[model samples]
Every structure is written in C-alpha cells, then in structure tokens.
Target: MPYATSAAFAHDWPDTVRLVTVEGAPHTGAWNADAYAYAYAYAKELAAFLAQHT
Candidate 1:
C-alpha cells in the first residue's frame, strides 16, 4: 500500500510466502474509510487465507 516501507517488505517476500494486495487501499486499509471500502469482505478473505495458511 502506497509503496511504503511495509509494502516494500511484502514485495520482497520470498516465493513461498503468501502475499495479498488490496488495490486502492491505504497504509491501514482495513480502517481506511476512503480506501478498502469493503473491509467486512476483506476481513472474511483474510480469515479464510489465515485458516488455509495456518
């Protein structure tokens, strides 16, 4: 998000890592009102991802 430090880390993650990118999202996308508007759905997606990964 925003090509910031955290985003750079995610981008540099190894191939085995799971990386999810929310388009048009801000730094803290889940709480950003103007960005990631569908946060409830995003939460569900994140939960599913964690469930599968962990």
Candidate 2:
C-alpha cells in the first residue's frame, strides 16, 4: 500500500481524525527510533503507574 500525499490527508481529515496505518511496518522499528523512545517509555511508565495507582 502507498501513503497518500498531504492533500489527501487534508481532505480526509478535514472534519474528522484520519488515522493512517503503515502497512508491513517493521516490528519494533518505532521502539528503535530515538524520537520514539520517549513516547514508548512514557506509554510504559503510564501503564505501570496506572496499574499501581488504581
């Protein structure tokens, strides 16, 4: 599958949230990206914190 251009996204998400999925995304690639580290860590910390808090 191919990703649509910005124009397509603009049209699709104009009135609603248009979510895109990466087909065949490499497993754990996001975890390896430096930019994604914080997000992944935050998600883990939030999950654990919620479990303990609740």
Worst 10 residues of 1 by lDDT: 14-23
Encode model 1's per-residue lDDT on 1-54: one tens digit a residue: 354665567668854444455567655664564444566666786898789889
Model 2 over residues 26-52: C-alpha lDDT tens digits? 434434445465476657767876786
**What's the TM for model 2?**
0.36
- For model 1, what is the C-alpha lDDT against the true structure? 0.62
TM-score of each: 0.43, 0.36
Candidate 2 residues lying further than 4 Å off, grouped into runs, are 1-33
